[model samples]
Target: MQIDIRAKGFELSPALREHAERRLGFALSWAVYDVRKVAVRLYDINGPRGGEDKCCRIQIALPGTSDVVIEDTEADLYIAINRAVDRAERSLARRLERQREHRHARQPVVEITDDDSAEEFEQRADAGVFH
Candidate 1:
């Protein structure tokens, strides 16, 4: 998946950007085929005066399905990113699983009828065809 990372209210360091990308990539590795893109935004809510005001927002795009968005805030940006990624992983799993179940539920179920061929097959089976 394509991942884009950006920061607000502060400069985004290479280390931070790399951290976000690595964490997100590993977390969603199982969904490579299903995921189209990932967008991450980090915010320093407290600015110079810090006090548990870091925010991490992640939006995941899935082809042919609704997007998933997850957000978390913590005293440290790393913590926020970790928490948000965890939440996104669980939410994405549930959404994809539900889609799979829905597709299966929509499939038509075939039924057997009392046709001549079916009757003949049944008779042969009753006679133990090979016995």
Candidate 2:
């Protein structure tokens, strides 16, 4: 999966980017759905009055579903990213589980007739109505 890292007030370094990727990748690897890409944004809250000011936003793309985005602000950027990624992972897991359950629930059950070689069954098969 592709990881896009962007910084607002500060320049993102190779080490930081790699660290974030490693952390996020580990979390997403356990997901049931395949992740197409992850986008992370880092920005420092400019106001002195805002407590827990560092902001981290993460967007995750999964198969057959809309992208999930999580935003968290904390005193530390790493903490914020970790929390946001954790939340995103949990949400994705729940969604994937629900989808799997729905698919199973919607499946039609096939029942075979008692007389395996009956003429009616043969006729149904010949008519392409039963297999």
Candidate 3:
């Protein structure tokens, strides 16, 4: 998967960049096959005046599904990045699970037997037992 990291309102240091990359790589490894790209944006919301203004936004692009976007804010940028990655992981898992369930719920195929007639097939099709 491709990862793009961006920093806003501050210069991004090598240590911080490496930390974010490592954390995200580990966190998203489970859904690596499903993920196409990841975009991470780190923001210093309050600039020099620090509060709970560190924001991390993570956007995951998944195949055949809508992108999952997660945002978290904390006093520490590392904590915000961690929380956002965790949330993104959970969101991607849930979406994949739902898609799997939907796919498995499709109508089953029907095999014609000598004893079965056209009327039987029609009835079964109407009742959604056959597709």
Candidate 4:
């Protein structure tokens, strides 16, 4: 997946960029095929004031599904990123599950075969052939 990391209101350090990249790479590895791109934005809400205003926002792009967004705020940017990534993982799982369920529901539950008799085919069609 493509990852775009940006910092707002503060200069992004190499260490911070590496940390975010590594964290997301490991966390979302299971979704490698499903996830297309990820954009992470870190914000220093208070800037110099510095109170628990660090924010991490992550937006994920998936094929055949709506994008997923997750955000977290904490005293430290690292913590915010960690929390946001965790939430994004859960949200992505849920969205993928819903997508699978929708696709499954739309498919026909029974298939016709040439070996089947007319009566059997009708019965199978009337009441789906469930395993």
Give the top-scoring candidate (lDDT).
4
The whole-model lDDT of each prediction reads 0.91, 0.82, 0.90, 0.92
Q: Is candidate 2 or candidate 3 better by TM-score?
A: 3
lDDT of 3 by residue, 28-125 (tens): 89888888999999999999998999999999988887899999999999999988988988888899999899988884767778887899988987
Per-residue C-alpha lDDT of model 2 across residues 10-112, encoded as one tens digit per residue: 7888877877888888988876247788899998887556578989999888778888889999988888888988898888788778888999998755446
RMSD (Cα, Å) for all candidates, in order, is 7.3, 3.8, 4.3, 4.1
TM-score of 3: 0.81
Candidate rank order under lDDT: 4, 1, 3, 2
TM-score of each: 0.82, 0.78, 0.81, 0.84
Q: Give the clashing residue pairs of candidate 2, or none.
A: none
lDDT of 1 at 7: 93
**Candidate 2: which stretches are off by over 4 Å?**
47-51, 113-131
lDDT of 2 at 74: 92
Candidate 3, which segments miss by more than 4 Å at Cα? 107-131
> What tens-digit string does per-residue lDDT give for candidate 4 at 1-36?
999999999999999999999999998999999999
List the lowest-lDDT window of 10 residues for candidate 3.
107-116
State how far residue 100 of model 2 sits from its true place (Å).
Answer: 1.1
